[model samples]
Target chain A: MDGNGVSGAARHAAFAPLDDGGRAEVVARRLSEAIALGLLGDGEQLPSEAELAAQLNVATVTLREALSALRSDGLVQTRRGRGGGSFARSPADASLERLRRTLRELTVHELREIGDQHRAIAGTAALLAAERAASEDLRTLDTLVDQLAGAGEPGDRRRADGRFHIELAAAGQSSRLTRQEIALQAEIGELLWMPSGEAVPHPDAVAEHREILAAVRLGDGQRARVATERHIGRGIDQLIDFHLRLARA
Target chain B: MVSDVRAEEMSAAAREVGTALDEVFAWLAELAGRFAAMHASSVAEQNQLRAADLSQLRASIFPRLTGNPRLLAGTGVIVADDVLADQPHWLEWWQHAQGGTELEFLEVDHDPASVGFYDYESAAWFVVPRDTGDRVVVGPYVDYSGTDEYMLTLAHPVSHDARFLGVAAADIRADAFEALLLRAIGAVGQPAVLANEAGRVIASNTPSKIAGSLVHEAEFAGSPVRVVLNQDAEVRDCAGLPWRIAALRG
Candidate 1:
C-alpha cells in the first residue's frame, strides 16, 4: 500500500540505511574483544560517552545506545560522578571456570571421536621423533622412557604421560609461557577421551619427550620450543577434529 | 585557736583513740554507702556508685576520713549487717580471686541469743560482739595477716518505725580507733580491745597480748564484766583504769 499510518512507518526499510541493533552489536563486540585481549586492564576506566563517541567518530546518542547494550552484557560495569567509568572484570580463575562450564558440552559419541582424534595426533608426533632424536636426546627423555616402559597398566602410562608433559613445561623455563601448556594438558586429562588400554601414550613418546629435553639441554631453544608446540598442538588439533566430528555427527 | 592548740596538746593516748575511733566509724559509713550503691545496686542496674556520691558522703558526714587514703582508694571489707542469702556470693568470689580483702554477709538462724560467728577463708572462726555473744569459744580466733588491724565488731538493735528488725552487727577497722585511743590515753604501743554489745572483740591494738589479761587481776576472778556498746550510753566511771565503756554513736 502506498499509504502509511501516522508514526507507524518502518523508516529504516524505506530510507535510513542501517539497523540500529546491528550497529549496537558492532560496538559491543569491539569492547568485548578489547577486554578479552586485556587491552583494557582491570581498574582502567573507559572513556566518557562524549570522548568515546568522538574517538569512534559516532554521534553521542549512538555511542550511548551502544554502551547501554554493553552494560547489559556484564562485560563492563559503571560507577558514578568524576571518578567513575567502565572496567573489565578479569577473573584469575577464568580457565578453571571455563573448563568447569564447558564440560557438559560433550556427548558420548563426540567423546569417542575426540579420543580417536587425540590418538592420531599424539601417535604421529611420537612416531616422528623416534627416527629423528639423537643419542643425548634419547637420554634426556630417559625418565619418561623408563616410566612408559615400566608402567603396570594403560591407566598408569596415561598418568606417566601427564607427568612427562608437565616436565616438558618445566623445560620451557618461562613460568608464564608454561602455564597454559600445563593447563591444556590437564584439561585433556579431564576430557578423558583417551583410550583405556591401547590408546595409552605410545612407547616411543617417552623417547621423543627425552629427545626434546636433550635438544633443550644442548641450548636448542628453537627445537625445544618447536617440539613443545608440536606436543601441545597435537592435543589442540585433536580437539578441533573432535569438535568437527562432533558437529558432523 | 587557743582551745584548738590545747586540744592538740591533749594526751597522745587519748588523741590516738579518738582518731582511731573516728576513722573506724567513718570507714563504716563509707562501707555502708558502697554496700548500698555497689553491693545493693547490683540487685538493680545503674552503677550509681560514682566518685561524686562517695566523695560527698565522705565530705558531708565522715570528715575524719575525708582525706583518708583508704576511703579514697575505695578498698576495704564490707559485710552486710544482716544475713539475707544462704551463701554470701560476694565474699566467696573475693576468696576465689585470692584477693586479700575480707567480706562478710550476715545470715539468720542464730544458735540461741543475739550471737553471730564470722567465718574466715583461713577456716578460723570469730564470733562478733566477741565473748558476750552467746557462743562457745573456738580459737585464737580469725588470724588476719593484715597490718595494724584494730577492728570494732558491734551488734546494736535497729528499729523500722517502732518495729524491731534483727540486731545489726558490723566488723569495722579498730586500728584507726585504737590508734586514736592510744593518742587519747597517752599509751604508746599499749594494747586495747573493743568488743561490742555481746562482748565480741571486734578489734584489738594488742589483742593477742591484752585480750587474754586485763593488766591487774580481776577482783571477781570470773570473766571480765563485758563492756556493752549501747547507742548514746556512756560510762565515765571506767575511764583511766585499763577499762572503758563508751557509748556507741553513729
Candidate 2:
C-alpha cells in the first residue's frame, strides 16, 4: 500500500524527489505524514525494499537510513525469518498529557501563526481548485466528502478529511500546491482535528467540506476561497479553545 | 437479554486471552531480568560476545519454555546488538522455524540489511518500553518475517542499572486467539471484537470484520459497560495493556 492512500498517479507525482541530500528525510516525512493521516493503516505490510526505494527514487542505502529513522520514531517495524518484512505499527494515541504539553510549549501567537499559514495555503488551493478542477476531479472530491460524512470513527473521519483537502489541492492541477498541502496537513492536520471530549464535533467539519466542495464544483473561485477560509478558521478557533482548556487543566 | 449473555461470553473470552498474556508477561519479565544480569556481567568482563552467545541463548530459552498449547503460536527473544553486520540472525531463525514446527523462535538485527533493509528500533514492542519504561503488549499484526500469521507481541525491557540491554519478547498467533474467541462468542449472532487502543480489531467473530481493520468505540455504544470506556470504545482493561473487549449488538 506504500501507506500514502493516494492513487498511484498522485503518489508518483507527490513523491518525486525534488532535491538530493535530504531525499530520505523527505521520503520519511511523507510516509510518516501518510501514516499519521491513517492513509497507511496499522499492520499494513510495506512494499519490498527495492520496490519502495525505486518508487521513492533513492539509493537503497538512503532508503535504509530513512527506514532506520522511522524505526527510531516507532512508526515502522522489521521482523526476520521466512515471511518477515517491515510492517506499520499503530501510532500511539496523542495522549492528553502530550497534548497538554504541546499546548503549554506553544504560545497563542505561534498557534495563530500556524493557523494563518494553513489558511493561506488552504484558501489558495481551494481558489485554484475551483478554477481548474475538471468534472472527474470534482467527482473525486465529492467521493472524498461523502467518505468524510459517512465516516463514524474520529480516525476515519480525520483521514478522509485530510484526503479531501489534498484532493482539492490536486483538483487545482498544481502538483506543487498539492505537495504543499500534503506537508501542511502533515504538520497541523492531526493536532487541528485531534479527538477531544466531543469539543469539535465532526459533523460541523463535514458540513463545511460539503460547502467547499459545492463551491468548487460550481467553479466559484471566490466562494470556494471563502468557504475554505471559514472552515479553517473555525478549526483554528476550536484548537485554540482546546489548547486553553488543556493548559488550564 | 441475549446481549447480556453475549457480553458475558465476550468478557470471558477476553479474560482468557488476558490471563494467557499475563502469564507470558510474567515469564518475559523474569527472562528479561536474567538477560539483563548476563548483559551487565558481559559488559563488566569486557567479553567480546559473538553471535554464538545469542544463538545459544535462543536455543536454551526458546526450546525450553512451553506456552499454552492452544493459545500461543510461538515464543522468542530479540537482543539489541550489532553482532551481525550484514545479515540478521532473526531471518536465519525465521528460515529455520519455517522448516520446523508451526511455532519457532526468531530474532532480528537492528541493522537494515540483515532485516530486509528495515530497522527494528521503529517497532512498538521495542520502542514503547524503551520510551515509557514499562512492559508493553503490541499488535495482532502480521509477523511477515516469522510465520506470516497475524500475531500479538509481549515485550519487556531488559535493562540493568539504567543501561538498556534489549527487549525480551514472545509472539501469540492471532488465529489461535480468534479461534478461541469464535468458540466463545461465535454463536451470539452479534459482532463481537477485541480491539487494541487504536481501535484495530485483534479478534472478531464477524468473518468480514477481520483483524487489523479500524473499529470505532461508538459502534459498540449498545454494549452494557458503556461509560467506563477509554477513547471511543466500550472497554475493559486486559493485561494492563490498552487492549479492550468490545461488542456491537444488533
- Runs off by more than 4 Å, candidate 2: A1-249, B1-7, B43-48, B64-74, B81-96, B99-115, B145-147, B187-189, B224-240
- List per-model TM-scores for chain B: 0.34, 0.73
Q: Write the per-residue lDDT of candidate 2 for residues B20-106, one digit (tens) a residue.
A: 566676667666766676666777887744545555455445443433655555554555555334324332232224434454435
Misplaced by over 4 Å in model 1 are: A1-249, B1-19, B38-88, B92-118, B121-180, B187-212, B216-250
Q: Write the per-residue lDDT of candidate 1 for residues A128-213, one digit (tens) a residue.
A: 33323333234535666588768754345656666565444333222222344345445566332232102223554565566666
- How much does each candidate deviate from the true structure in C-alpha RMSD? 36.5, 23.1
| Cα lDDT of model 2 by residue, A18-105, tens digit | 3656567767765664454344556767778888787777888888888898898788899999889987665667553354456557
- Model 1 chain A is weakest, by summed lDDT over 10 consecutive residues, at A6-15
CAPRI grade of model 2: incorrect
Evaluated at residue B91, the lDDT of candidate 2 is 22
Question: Which digits, one per residue and each the tens of the lDDT, describe model 1 over residues B7-83?
Answer: 33333333343444334444444444443444344335634233223233333223332345332212333232232
